[model samples]
Target: MIGQDDSRLHTAVLVGPEGERRRARKARRQAAAKVETDARRHRKVQARAKWEAEQAERRNTSYLPPAGEAGPAALRTPGRFRLPKHQDTSATLAGQYPFLAEAGLGNQGVFVGQDLYSGGSFVYDPWVLYQRGLITAPNVVLAGIVGSGKSSLAKSLYTRSLPFGRRVYVPGDPKGEHTAVAEAVGGRAIILGHGLRNRLNPLDEGHRPSAVSDAEWAMQVASRRRDLIGALAETVLDRPLSPLEHTAIDLALRDAVRSAEVPILPMVVDRILSPNTADDEDGRLAEDGRLVGHALRRLVAGDLQGLFDGPSTVRFDPSLPMVSLDLSRVAENSTLISVLMTCSSAWMESALSDPAGGQRWVIYDEAWRLMQYPALLRRMDAQWRLARHFGIANMLIFHKLSDLDNVGDAGTAMRALASSLLANAETRIVYRQEPDQLGSTALALGLTGTEQKLLPGLGTGQGLWRIKDRSFVVQHQLHPAELAAFDTTGRMTSDSHEFRNLDVRSGIPNDRRDS
Candidate 1:
């Protein structure tokens, strides 16, 4: 029996050893499979690297220097292209492309670039490089010693934007560039010529100008004008007016308008302009009164009434796609420009307040003039307040930074205001500028050395486009037709001139002429 038990134990031990050998064989097979998989992956990586090298070679072969650069291929190092640093980051990569950024091929927008020699180039990119919607509407301040293509740039942008279905409302001064674009884009161009008539009149419909009972509209207009009125009074009166004083004046004006038999603006003006019995050294007080009176009279009797009470007062239609307010004709009348800007602010406020989501853009060329009026300044403030809600993007064009110096506190307030606009913009396009203006523009736009270099040697239409957190600058080219359309002088075409005569009555008052 002992011998049999020993034999069974020996057999059990042998079987156990065999089982262990089988398990080790299975483990070895698994390890071999994993190694094979890794080898395959390595081979795939090598193939990809080889393909990439070939692509690089092809790209290098295709590289060409900027059109005018005189260089042989051997002498010139090919331009190195790398993905923008912002693209590597998680934040901007995920964020929407703002209009301030150079739009890409994926965004379905066109990036127009121009050089002094070739005129312009148009690139259609469907992708947006930066989310323009994120930026604040820029108030453009264009300044040049009269021949630097300031007006042309404005017209180019306006015309280019038309095909995209933007509504541009330009209160054109007599220069007529804005009017021409409006007509070109199938928009109604109302020249503020002699005896301009309103197609729709709230007054004749047995409705008072303010009788619509739009409390919101009244509040919006008043709110936007508040700071501006104070600023204006300070400038005109040569003394700071307290908030309480401003409120009191505002209330008095409202009460006069509400209680008056005739239009209350004229009455309010008279009251504000009435002589102050308190002091004799009140030259500023008298001037303030006159300016205020003049402004009010112009508001009451000018095309501004149409702006406030006509079809424009109705909310903008997102479906309409594009709208342009030609203020070029009204540029001469600083007060009128103020009124239109005020009306635009109020209108934009109303439009944005509507819950149906709509995106809009406001482009201002030579916007420095707009800043001269406290009302426009206040309107810009309102734009800042309602930026996100309205999805309104502003593209401001300016030739030099110093041009802003003419507004109010010279360049200081202008700089501050511009800074606010810059802070809000997600993308900034800087064209060629004088050396002195470079630092301020860079500082304001937050540009890098590459971007700064892009600015210095750029031709007329070529410039650097920078986006927040972006490392690379994009070269923009404008279309040839668009380049041809840019108006160096604010002149109207023959058709536009004939169209101006179509309206017999001038929209502007004869007494308070523009400029």
Candidate 2:
């Protein structure tokens, strides 16, 4: 009975409230086991996701070729890299190596200066480029505002070329900027203006080519003289000569040549005013030439007296390193300037026609002033077209490209010729320009957007050079001596003896100074 009671107590302790607690504990243990199993499954799922992420990262990574391995399959080939490396240009390589690139005009020309973009030494020689088939036309067009160092660049190009056996001929230096340069380079500058003893006889036989026959020479002389007289008359008259006026000029030129060994403008004027009895059948020859005669008389005895009234006191020798006609004195008078330039143009033909004349540089400074006259513009156009045949390079320098529109009314022959001058030149150098001129300049040069944007921000001595199909932004460097000799702003900068030597009040240069 005591054992049974103990058993019941044990049972009660185990199965009653105790037994209930024990069963609850058993259920809690079962539930705890199930929670542990669920936690393990969750950990396995997290591990699987981490493993999948690692595999995906490995698959997305770029796979470069293994060391010393060479095969198409070794690399993750991009669509752009399919072409052979040797078949592509660096311009294409920029897409690959965008940080490092260099495109330069080759290494066989003069050391011009520095290439502002590539940080390389810039070199250029037009004759060399032409021989290499890099450019078809050797002429150049340099445009810049005043005081942009365009003057110095012009001087340096030709002066540096002197050692290379090239000569420079500046047909007209309106500011007389080239006077000092010519003297420094061992060249001659003919000074012609009022009160100067120097005289230019345009009728004199110019430099004769070695290949011309007597007949050809005679024909050239007569044609040149007749054309010169007609040009002078037209320029003074401010209109083209009529057919009757042309006939009168031809008769007068012939008679003058027949009478005087060295004909003068006075002779032509007098003959035009009073023709010989034989040529004036109905006395209409004198009437036809009367207006033209008085017009040309200005050069002999009127406002343009003291120059071209007599024989040429100075001769033009083509062998000099440089030759320039200083026209600073007459720049104030448009008519006088045009007349002088017309005479100089006739003079240039003499030297330019010589076959024996070596390669030369013909520079037209202040071209805006020269292009205003139709006669001068025509002569310039002819010379520009014949640049290649004459073995010469013509450089036209003007202040602004808008000067072209100012050359003549739109669609006129002057406008066309002026526009053609720009077209013929394959080498175009643009210095800093005014904001107003940027559009026309960009259009005229076919500059890219970046290039067009580079104009206004350009610093001094920097210029954009477009040579044929290539382009370069170069910083022109000059020696101290060159800066001094090529200086055109002396009057505005520092007043020196050289500046004082010029007509100070009138702003004329020292054209006659032996400096």
lDDT of 2: 0.87
78-158 per-residue lDDT for model 2 (tens digits): 565555547575458767877673477678766778887677888777888888888888899998887687888888888
For model 1 the TM-score comes to 0.54
- The deviation in Å at residue 264 for candidate 1 is 5.3
lDDT of each: 0.51, 0.87
Write model 1 residue lDDT over 390-423, tens digit each, in one string: 5555556566655555655645654566556656
Candidate 2: residue pairs that collide: 14-19
Best by TM-score: 2
Cα error, candidate 1, residue 293 (Å): 5.3
RMSD of each predicted structure: 16.8, 23.4
